[model samples]
Target: MKKAAMTIALLIAVVATAGIVTGGFSYDPAAAQAAARIKVYSAEMRNYFMSDEIVKSKEEWRKILTQEQYHVLREKGTERAFTGKYATTHDHGIYRCAGCGLDLFRSEDKFESGTGWPSFTQPIAKENVKTEVDRSFFST
Candidate 1:
C-alpha cells in the first residue's frame, strides 16, 4: 500500500512538473486569494466538507500563532528535525494544520519514517490538504 501510494504521488509530481515546464501550470495569486473558503476538516466537526475555513492576514496570523509558527507557516520556514512536539508523539487523535485548525491526518495513518518528522501515510481525506509544486528560491 505504501509503495502504491508513493508511486501515485510520484506520478502526480512528474505530471505537475511537466505541466510547469510546459507553461501549463502557471500560478495565479489572485486565484489563491479568491479561494478564501476552502474545504477543511476538524475532529469536532466530524465532517470533512463541513468545517469552516479560516483565512487571516499575515498580521493577524502573526498575532495568533507563535513566533516559530509564524516563521514556519507564513515565511515557509521548516522546523529543525526532531524538534517538533509531535515528531515522536504517539497520541491518539487527528493531526491538524498549525496555521489553521483543519484536520489533516488520522492517527492510524501516522508512521515512523525515521526522518525525525511526523509522517503520515495519507491524509484523512483528499481535500483536506492542497499540494502544489514549490517554486521558491531553493526549489530546483
Candidate 2:
C-alpha cells in the first residue's frame, strides 16, 4: 500500500509539472519569437520599430489614421503651428508614427526650436523616412 501511494503521488507531481509547463503557465510563444527576431544594428538603433503588420489596403489607412497623421504619413501633412504632442513631452522613448508604427525620432534627439511642432535634430535613419515638398496655399 505504501509503495502504491508513493507511485501515485509521483505521477500526480509529474502531471502537475507538465501542466504548468504547457497550458497552465502564461508563456507567449509568439511574443518570444518576435523578441528573438529583433535585430539591433547600432547603439543608436537599440529601440525596435515594428511596421504595421495588418497590411491595410490604401482605403483602410484612409479610414483609420486621423486626417492629420494620414496627411503627414501618406500625403506629408505637416502639423499646424505649435500643436504636436512630441514637442512638449519629456518622456524617454522612441516616437513612432501613430499611423504606421514607424520610428520617427528618439526622445534624446528632441530639442526646443521654438517651433510649435516637435523638432528633432536627427532621426534614427534617413532611409526610414521619405520627404517631399509641400506647396500649400496655407503656407503662403
Candidate 3:
C-alpha cells in the first residue's frame, strides 16, 4: 500500500509539474515549487526578493504589503485565535518575517503551546532576533 501510494504521489507530482489543468484549476509548477521552497535553511544569497534593511515609506509599505500583512507585521496586529495559515503548519524549514524576510524561527523549535500561536523555542540566529513588549489588544 505504501509503495502504491508513493507511485500515485509521484505521478501526481509529474502531472502537476507539467502544468495540468483540472476542473478550472491550473497548476503552475514554478509557482508551486517556489512557495514550497520559501522555507530556507540559511542565508546564502546577497540580494533575494529584497535587500537587507528594506526601508520604505508607509505609503510604499501600504502599496506593497497585503491587508493582513500590513496589519500584522506593520501594526503588530494579531489574527484571531486559530486563524493564521501558519499557526499549525509543521513544515521543516525556516520561518522568515513576512515583512522583512528576516530569518526568525526553525521548524525543530516549533511547539504546540495551546494558545493557537506559532511558538518557537529556538531562533536560528540571536543577532536577528529581538524582543519587544507587545502592547496590542491581545498582549499578555
lDDT of 3 by residue, 13-125 (tens): 98886665453366688866655443323444522342234568999989978998999878778788888988999989888887777877879999999999899897776
lDDT of model number 2: 0.71
Q: Which ranking of candidates, highest lDDT first?
A: 1, 3, 2
lDDT of 2 by residue, 1-140 (tens): 99999999999999999998776757798876675543222235564554324457778898988887788777755787777766688899887768756676778998988877787888766645556675676785
Clashes of each: 0, 3, 0
Off by over 4 Å in 3: 1-52, 135-140
Q: Where is model 2 more than 4 Å wrong at Cα? A: 1-56, 133-140
lDDT of 1 by residue, 71-101 (tens): 9878878899999999999999988878877
Question: When superposed on Cα atoms, how far off is each prediction in RMSD?
Answer: 12.6, 18.9, 19.5
TM-score of 1: 0.65
lDDT of 3 at 90: 95
Candidate 1 clash pair list? none
Which pairs of residues clash in candidate 3, taking residues 3 or more apart in a chain or in different chains?
A: none
